[model samples]
Target: METSAYLNAVVEQTNTLAGWVHGRDATAPVPTCPKWTLADLVDHVGATQRMVAMLVGERMTEPDSAYARYVPAPGDPAQWRDWLTGTAAEAEQAFASVTDDTPVWDPSGAAAGVPFWSRRLFGEACVHRADAAAALGLPYELAPELAVAAIEDWLDTLTSRGYWENRPDFADAMRGSGQTLHFHATDASGEWLARREPDRVVLERTHTKADITVRGPAADLLLVLSRRRPLSATPTLELHGDRTLIDRWIEHMDWVTGD
Candidate 1:
């Protein structure tokens, strides 16, 4: 996705969130995020936007210092909608001001650039928007392009050797004798094959057989991968082959923590 598309997605998702929670109960529980209320989820998105703005806008080189300088919004639920929208705009301007190749701090030690941060912010906004939807009992929808990009970015993160270096437990659990988990977006030209190797997780964009296959619209697949909803419960998703393999993959994937 282009930087502009990511920025637009961030705006759309955050704006949808603001509208969804408007005049609703701030203390409503987000089923997807058991520990956070509606207000807490909004605050999380706003703070994340501000942090990304600082990281990309200021071109901060160190993660710790950048995080240390971060600030949270005031504890006022009534003003959260305005705060969320303001931070989204701030993130948009920050990303737009820099070229995609510009260097930046990335906590995960993945590829660090303006493009990476923009994509990260968009994924954050998209998934959290799903959280809000679950909390409010509203249906959620995402553009096919945005959904595909999100799933790709997330899979890259999950399979990154750099990321797994710090997550030995997950790495160990995910290792297998060439078992594969396939994901097919039936509604669009999106397809991927994830193979669990003895030492690492290998991912590829291809159409092939696997131990298990998940077929659905790109948006629903994104949600299932995000673990905001279960694959078995969502009728829109079709599962073929070994259910245990996919279940095990999802179980291990749950340990990959990020907004």
Candidate 2:
């Protein structure tokens, strides 16, 4: 969507996530992110917001080696809600002050502009919000528009030759001849065909069937595509044709480590 919409999601998602943190088990495991507990996720989400806020606010053209200005919050988990909401507002304001074309640094080597953060940060917030929902046994939902945009942004990262060049294992895993994975979002006008070639993966918008088809609402597909949720675990996602190809795609080519 637009920049304002993304910023709105950042605020909405982080606040919702903060609300979930209150009176909950801080040590609870996030099934989606095996490496983090509820507390870790909160810290990550909030800290990342502050960091991105700094980056956008300064119009940084290169990566910062240190963000020591940000210290760990001292209070118990009960205090996290306030901290998270404050950071989210700071980030929202910073993101709003910058224009889409405003130049900035990005660790992913993607676009050198605030637009990149707006897109990536929104997807990150959406995926992690899903994580919090799963941890709390609460139903998770997303706007179809956000889901479609998120999937599109994430696919841009995945298929980017410049991005995977730094991760040889991921690059190698994406290479194959004639194998394709099709993602169809039933709830919105989102359909993508991912074709694997000998050298790189290519993404396009189309209806032609691939070796496998993943059909669902854009939100569900976004969650699965983001690697926060697996395609097989949810019977809600309609998986037709080669399950192995879809499984392999999820195994190696589905994750993006970013804020």
Q: lDDT tens string, model 1, 1-259?
A: 7899889989988988988876678889988887788878877888889988988898887767667877776566667778888999999999888897888867565665787788888888888899989999999998887788888888877787766788888898888989999999887778999998998889999999899999989999998888888877789999999999888877776632332
lDDT tens digits, residue span 6-27, model 2: 8888888888888888867788
TM-score list, all predictions: 0.93, 0.90
Tell me the spans in candidate 2 whose CA falls farther than 4 Å from its real position.
Answer: 65-70, 73-75, 253-259
Q: Which predicted model would earn the best lDDT?
A: 1
lDDT of 1 at 223: 88
lDDT of each: 0.84, 0.81
Span of 10 residues, lowest total lDDT, candidate 2: 250-259
TM-score of 1: 0.93
